[model samples]
Target chain A: MMGNLLEHMGVERDRLHFSWISSAEATKFVDVVKEISDKVRALDTDKKFAKDYTK
Target chain B: MDTCIEKIRTICADLLAKGKVQKVIGFAEGSIPMASRPIAVTSKEDVAKLVFNATCGLNLANYVSDVLPKEGKIAVTAKGCDSRNLVTHMVENQVSRDQLYIIGVPCTGMVDKRKIAALFEDEITDFIEDGDTLTIVSPQKKEKVSKKDVLRHNCRVCTHRNPVVFDVMAAEPVEEQSLDQPFADVDHIAAMDPAARWAHFQELTKNCIRCYACRNACPLCYCPTCFVDESSPQWVGKGQDKTDINTFHFLRAFHCAGRCTDCGACVEACPMGINVRDFTRKLNKDALELFGWEAGLDMEKRPPLDVYSPDDPNDFIK
Candidate 1:
C-alpha cells in the first residue's frame, strides 16, 4: 500500500520493491537485487522527494 | 434539525442519569459561527449543551480513546464517519465495542466553513441553518445560500451517510451520494506527468508550517511518538524546509494508507487551508480499487494492508 501510494504521488515505480525470499534462496535474492538496481538506474535521479537542507 | 438535537440531548441525559456510561462525547456550540467543537458531558445537566447540526464537522471519535475512562463506559455521538473511525479503533484495539454506546446521527453532510467564509469579505457574525438553506450574517449584509453549495468536498463524495454500526439511532438515515466519478480529484492528479504531479503536491504543501494539525485531528494517528518526532533515527527534519514539509505530508499520508475514513477532520483542522485529503485520498482510491476495502466498516476484519493473504495482489513485487 505504501508503494502504491508513493507511486501514485509521482515517485518512480522502481524506487520501492517488495519480495519474499527465504534464507536458502540466495540465487533468488541476488536476481531480485540485480533487477531492482537495473530498474532504479534506468530512471532519472529522484530530485523531487529528496530534501536539500543546504538551501 | 432541532428535533435531532432534542433527541440526542434526551438520549444522552438518560444514559448519563442512569449511569450507563461514565461520559458522553458530543458537540457543543462554538463561540464562532459554523464551528461546533467537541465536548465531553459527564452529567445530565450538561446534556442541554450537547447539540448536533451540520456545523458539527469535527469527528467525535478522535476523543473516544483519549477521553475514555479507565473503569467505565462512554457514550459517543456518532455520524457516519465517526462511527467508521470507532470501528477502526475497535479493529486496532484502541477501544472496545463493549466500552462504547454509539448514538448514531444520520449526517446530512457538513458544510465547509471555508467555502462559506469565502463568499463574504467581512467577518460572519452569525450563521443560521433552516432545512436546506443557510443564512450567513456579516456586518455588511445577510445572505442565504443553499446548503448543497457549501458542503465539504469529502462529504459531497461520501457514499456512507448512515452509520455502519450503531447502538442507537438519532434520526433517519440520509441518502448517500452516488457519483459516477467518486475519485475524480485523485484521477486528475494521477493523469498528470510525474514532474507535474510532484510540483502539484509541492505547491499544495508549500504553506505547511509543520503544525501537525492534520495529524492531531486524525484518529488513526495515535502513535505515542510520531515518526517525525523520532530523534535517535531522525526520519524528517523539524525545520520548515520544503523537503521536510513534503516528507511530513508524504509520511503522514502513508501512515494512514488503508486506515483513513475520509472524515475530513484533517482538512477542517488545517489552519493553512491546505487540502490534506489530496495525499490520503489517493491511498483510499488505491485501497478501494486494489483491495476492495474501505476502512472502519467491519470490526471483525483487519485492514487489507495490515494483514497478508495468499491471494493478495503483488504485481509490484519482482
Candidate 2:
C-alpha cells in the first residue's frame, strides 16, 4: 500500500527508507531517523518536490 | 456448557431486538473440528451458535478496528487479554469507549491449538472441554491433558485477570497474577553480546515473507495509514529483499513501543516462526523501567511516546 501511494504520488523509491529499532535502542532509532532526515533534506533542491511529503 | 450458550443467545437476542447493538461479534464453532473462530452475528437466529470455552483464544478485540458500525454500538466478546486490548485502544483514543458494548468472560486460560497439534503426529478427530481439562480423540488413541499444560505461554504469567473495562461481565472476575518476573527472555537477550544478538535476529528474520500478519494481529496497530503503507514519503521499501523485511519488522516493533500489551498475537500469527515477542517484550520492559508505566493496565494513563518530557532521560543521545 505504501508502495502504491508513493507510485501514485510520483515519489522515487530510493528516497524512502525504513529501519527497526528496539525500545532499548533509543539511540539507534534517533540515529536512523536523523540519517533519514538528513537524506531527505539533501534531496530537497531548488525544485519544490511536493510539500505533501512533510507529514 | 449448553447453559452458557443459551444465556449468550438470550442476551444477544435482547440486545439486537432493543436496537442496543447493530452487530454482535463472538466465536462460533469453526469449519475445522476442535477449533473456534471469530464470527459476526447480525440476527437473533445466529446468536444461538455463540460459544465460550478454552479454545476461544483468538483476540476478538482485533475485530473492533475491522468492523465499524454505521448507526448503533457493536457488541464484542472479550476474555482477559482481549479486554486489556480494548482498554489500550480506548487509552490511545483509537476507539471511543461509548461506541462499544463489551461482554467480558473470565478466562481460566486459552489453549494453544498449535502446541496441541505439535504434541500429536496423527490428525485430531475430535476434542472435549471438561472444565480445565481437555480430552483429545484421534483414530488411533484418545488422551486427556490438563488445560494448564497446553495454555499459551503468555497466559501462564499474565497479570491482568479481570476485564480492565467492560459493559457487562459474564462471570466473576479472577484475581490478577503476580508478574514479578516479567520479561525474563528480554534480560537473557540483553545479556548477549552484540554479534551473537545480531546473529540470532538474522536467523529469526531471514525467512520473513513480509506477510504483515504480525501488524494485522496486533491490537495497537490499528492505524488506517501505517507508516509502512504511507507512500507520500515512502517510509519503507516495497521489495522482497531480506533487508526490507527486516526493516518492516523493526519499524513496526518500534511503532508499537510503549503501546504494546505483550499479547504475543504477532508471534502466534507469524508464519516464519520469528520470535516477534522478543522485541515487543523488550519494549514492554523498557516502558516500565524507564518511564515506570505499563500499557493497557490503566486507561487513564497516556502512552510514553505520545507525550515527551523535557527532563526525560536521554542516555541514548550522543
Candidate 3:
C-alpha cells in the first residue's frame, strides 16, 4: 500500500526494492544486494520526489 | 431522553463538586436549531448547560488534545468513535489517560444538518426524534423523515455504536450493527482503472477552496507544527495550486494511516460537502485488510504501524 502511495507521489516504481532474507544467508543476501544495485543503477538519474537543493 | 440528560448533569455536578474533575467538557444548546456548541463547565451550577442529543456530533476528544488544561482532571463525553479517538490520543501520548474522566454515551446516531437542509431546501427550523421517526420543520412545511434516512452517512454504516471504554455509562449498551463488507465504498474506487481513479479523485477535489477545516476538525491532527506549516523544509507550497492541495490532502490522510477513527468530524466540518472520507476510508480499508486490525477499538493493542512481527504480511515487500 505504501509503495503504491509513493509511486503516486512521483517516486518511480522501479526505484523501490524490497526483499526478505533471514540471517546467516550470506549468499542470498549478496544476491539480493546485486539485484537491488542493478535496479538502482538502471534508474540512478531519476529522483522525481527530490528537489534541487542548489536553489 | 430525560434519563440521559439527568444522568449527565448529575454525574458532572458530582464530579465537579466532589473535587474529582476540575472541569466537564460536553455540548450546550447552540443558537441554531440543529447544531450544538462544545462548552466547558467549571462549576456545579453550570452543569445544567450540558446537553447531549443528536446534534452533539462534534468530537469532544478533538478539543481535549488541542487545549492542554492548566490543572485538574477533565471529564469528557464520548460516543463510540470519540472514545476510540481518546484511546488513540492515549496511545499517541497526546493526552494522558490518568487525567481524563470519560463519560461514555450510547450514541443512537447524529443527524446531518446539511442533509436536512438539502432535503428541505432550507435551514432546519426545528427537529424532533421519537422512536425511529424524525419530524423536521422547515420554513415551508413540517415533514416526517425516517430517522434512519437523516442520519449522517458514517453513523448509518457504523459498526461500533457503543463506547468501548468509559468511566461512567450514560445509557444502556446499544446493539452493534454487523457489516458484511465495510469496504464497499473504498472498493468502488479501487476497482477503477488507474487513470480513471486519478480523474475521479481530481473531480472529487475540484471544488476544494484550500480550506483546512477538515484538518483542524480531526483529533489525530494535533501536531503543533503540521507538515503543511513547516517553513524550514517547505514540504508543501502555500497556495491554491491543485497539485499542492492534492498533495496536502494525500499526505494528511497518510499521516492518519492507522489512527483515524472514521468519526465523520472531518466530513461534518467541510464546507464544500466533499466526502474526504473517500480518501481516509480507503486507508481504513487497507489498515484492516493488511493488518487485520481496526483502530481505536482496542486499548491493549497498539496501532498497526507501532509494532511489527516477523509473520507480518510481506507480499508487497518483494
Candidate achieving the largest DockQ: 1
Better of 1 and 3 by TM-score: 1
Best by lDDT: 1
State the lDDT at B209 in candidate 2: 81
Chain A (alone) TM-scores for all candidate structures: 0.84, 0.56, 0.73
User: Candidate 1 local accuracy as lDDT?
Assistant: 0.91
Clashing pairs in 2: A2-B229, A20-B250
* DockQ of candidate 2 against the true complex: 0.04
Instruction: Indicate the worst ten consecutive residues by lDDT in candidate 3 chain B.
Output: B64-73
Error of 1 at A14 (Å): 1.4
Question: Candidate 1 DockQ category?
Answer: medium
What proportion of the true contacts does each candidate reproduce? 0.76, 0.00, 0.22
Q: What local lDDT score does residue B27 receive in model 1, on the 0 to 100 scale?
A: 96
Better DockQ candidate (1, 2): 1
Weakest 10 consecutive residues of candidate 1 chain B by summed lDDT: B309-318
- Tens digits of per-residue lDDT for model 3 on B1-318? 446878999999999999999888889989877778789898999999998878777788999964457676899989999999999988888788888999999888888878778888667788776757778897888988876788888898898889988999988988888888787777777677655766677788778887888998898898889999999999988776666777788888889887888999988888898888887887787788888878898877988888887867777665
Deviation (Å) of B262 in candidate 1? 0.3
- Give a tens-digit lDDT track for model 1, residues B219-244: 99999999999998999999888878
For residues A1-55, could you state the per-residue lDDT of candidate 2 as single tens digits?
Answer: 2322222223444466756678999889888889877877876452212223343
